[model samples]
Target chain A: MSTDHLDGNAAAGALREIFTTDLTAATGTCASCGNVATVAQAVLYTNAPGLVGRCPGCEAVLFRLVRGPGRAWLDLRGVTCLEFALPDPS
Target chain B: MATVSRGFFGRRRSGDPDLPPGQYLVTDFPVLSAGPTPRLRTEDWEFTITTETGEKHAWDWAALMALPAQTPTVDLHCVTKWSKLGTSWRGVSLDTLFEDVESAAEYALVHSYGGYTTNLPLQDLLDGQAWIAYEFEGEPLEPEHGGPARLLVPHLYLWKSAKWVRGIQLLHDDEPGFWETAGYHNYGDPWREQRYWGD
Candidate 1:
């Protein structure tokens, strides 16, 4: 199976779609402390590998996917979208 | 995504402070920013600032350049672990940018392309040390390095020193950006080594 079908842009777009859709919708029991929380930021960078999310109540970094299979995927992931506020200086 | 033994905010093998002293150079530009003086093909370039209250100001290149410029020599520590020191950038200070605005927000979210973003304390944004740099190495900044204009907070990790920065939006609450939302330290305090996913 030729993987040439994935352009960096296309793959990035797909990831972005995931973030806006499934990733954003994901909420589960926190692996640490067994508290329910939401994913804050899904890290896609290799050096700082992991799926980082925050506890809704304690704000602790509960679920960490550091240094594992996901670590490898983060290396190849490209930034798809950046959400920020557009404040008016006036 | 190669993992370097050296982390952006981990203990150095030499045990030197994580922060760069004052004369190091981090040149991952060209391929990273833009290669050279990206020609402004048209009179369409604009730099704007937004407030947490949802106010915005747009400035053309000339208008932005018209703002007072200051030369600040600061140490830049990148999230990738390399620190460039003694770099002097001259541009408009954020205090000057938000001078006339009477917004009461306490924080600002810096926005940029390349899927990068970071948050800045309102005080830090107003810090005279912070500037929207247009020139580097005594020349116009290269686009790859946030040419024309880029936010340079010498005190914070270079990631917080956002590249290709187009605007700063004042915020009432602390909202994380692309990297911060992921696992990168929210504040990116170099002194605290708030560098990666968790502290």
Candidate 2:
């Protein structure tokens, strides 16, 4: 399907609910294919049963979000590691 | 608690008798992918079946077309809670492909052209349950829908049906595939609402 929706930036709002930093600017490595890319570069599918973020290089699903009435489930098993930039003190 | 979006819920269609629990009906076939769609020529396409012992069975496009095909109308449920009913597809059955091979493996990992994988019990793929579908709605499947060929395991959540499927790896031990290892349910049965780990 055509990726008409925005990239992983579409996930920034949901992710901000759990993380203090802006995840859209974070970098991640795909555990399955070893491809590294910024979270914003990954593909996002918001129409499915949940919000699914997939790696841009290998298409491996990097994370999934399922928000319930009072709880949210975030799955990040597809990412081997994530590097978040430190805020500049200057 | 985090706020939920109402957009996540599609409108329910009346008179729909086959949808699973916690799903809404969608008229459009939404495209969901992790990466750019791989453009592959049918001439170069091949489907392989590798047994646990390393024996290999391969079929190119022509060889695959030589086999009998069946068109089945089935309902699809996505783990994300969208249901598309009566989708039609034409392809050879896994039973037809596995008829010649003899293996004792209880689990199988479906590999896709784009390095995606999903695991399932070997039994879930046999006995007229699944197909390597290449045609959707009487047209050659589109790459976005896993053209060339995609695994169709309608009974499970759609993720279990790996798109752009390339091969099947039979294994004695159950291995977590891309989604399974990533916290999606190992056996994604929509009826049971098995969308993630511990679901």
Candidate 3:
């Protein structure tokens, strides 16, 4: 559903920047690898607001990585580390 | 009025206690399994139909369309519980696609982007209902929806409905795809209620 269409290359670049910093701060593991599981890439799209980056280790892609309307909710798809960061932990 | 047959995510049923609803929809278009229109123009788009005898019949998109078109109304059930009914689609019947291919007795493999793949008995692929769709709802299919073309098998779960489909490869055995190997049902039969892991 990602209609916030940044140029594909640009989106990819933005994801790279987000992965390097924000993700590492939030989760120590790589987004792609799930091994080191550290943040490797991140991109914020107007459409897929909470969407995150792919896994750094395996290059496995995870669509719509973020959770929340204005960045408050976190639907981590049951991801443990991510859920812990939520203000209203379920 | 013809209504699409559908069910909800969860519903109360007498005697059965509870039956999970599975939703889906059908299209009234030529749902062809299309390959990527390479970013480059003038690039050759090649496809092949393999047979049990190990024979391969190859063709370009133009040549393939020239063969014939048959329309079938089918019930498309996605793994996500979305079902569409009486969707009309026109395409070369799998039987006709295999005409002269000489391997009707073998299995068929469908390959696509994102490492998605699935297998069907040659019998299933040859079903007159199967198609390599080119249009959806009377319009040229869009890219985000796997436009230009896509494979539409109304009989199976929609994930088996590989987007950005390319070619048909005849195989002697079944092979699980990215989803299937990751625990999706191999056959993906919706009516049989096959969907995710252990189904």
Candidate 4:
């Protein structure tokens, strides 16, 4: 199948269900490719069992999500680590 | 069979027996895809079904159009919790395609033009349960919605109804598809709430 994919921002809404901050702006490294980039740069594929985010460098899956009536599942096996920012103290 | 939509303005009436568990009603058909949509021209498109022994049954646009088509009205339950009921579709039945095909295979791996694959029990595709739908609600299906033709198997979760369908490879053993391998339920049955690996 010749497929197209959107960037991680396309999945920000669905991800908001779990994250308190902008996970899209957080830097993450792909477990397979070691490419470190903000989640927004990740290629996202919507329209399946859930939203999938892949690495731009290797096309390896970085995250997977599946939602139900009252529950949601997010898999980040392809992501090695994620770095999020905290608000500055006054 | 009354129409129900939980729109931005109103709430849905709980306990609607028609919908499977964990599903909500949607008046609008939501577009979801694992990748970008494939634009397939009918003239260049062909469908194939390969038996376990490598016997190929192929049909091009013209050959497919010549077959007797059926209109099916069915409900669609998505793993994302959206369910659309009483949708109409026009296409050739899988029964006609598999009528004379010889295969002892119990499973089928459906391939799509976009490199997407979804597998299911072969029996789920026959006996009027499936179709290669070319039209939806009296209109030619558009590319994003799996135009040209898409597998229409309303009995299972919509994911099993592969979009941008290309062919089927009959297999003796069960095969996990794109989503299935990506932590999705191997056999996605919406009614059973099988949305993930264990559920």
Question: Top DockQ: which candidate number?
Answer: 4
Taking all chains together, each candidate's TM-score versus the true structure is: 0.61, 0.78, 0.59, 0.75
Q: Per-prediction TM-score, chain A only?
A: 0.29, 0.74, 0.30, 0.75
- DockQ of each candidate, alpha-carbon based: 0.07, 0.16, 0.04, 0.22
Candidate 4, lDDT over the whole model: 0.86
Q: Distance (Å) between predicted and true CA of B120, model 2?
A: 0.4
Interface RMSD of 4: 6.3
**Model 3 C-alpha lDDT per residue in residues A12-86, reported as the tens digit of each score:** 854565545444446534344454443334322222112334444443444333222233322232122441133
Better of 1 and 3 by lDDT: 1
Q: Predictions ranked by TM-score, top down? A: 2, 4, 1, 3
Q: Is candidate 1 or candidate 2 better by TM-score?
A: 2
Query: Between prediction 1 and prediction 2, which has the larger lDDT?
Result: 2
In angstroms, how far off is B153's CA in candidate 4? 0.7
RMSD of 3: 13.0
Residue B96 deviation, candidate 2, in Å? Answer: 0.5
Q: Model 3 scores what on Cα lDDT?
A: 0.53
Candidate 2, residues A1-90, lDDT tens digits: the string is: 786778898898656754887788889999989999998998886644457788888677888766644556678888999888875545
What tens-digit string does per-residue lDDT give for candidate 4 at B1-199?
A: 1123446413444767778887777878888877767888899999999999999999999999999999999999887678888999999999999988999999999999867799999999999899999999999998878999999999899988888899999999999887787677988888788888878
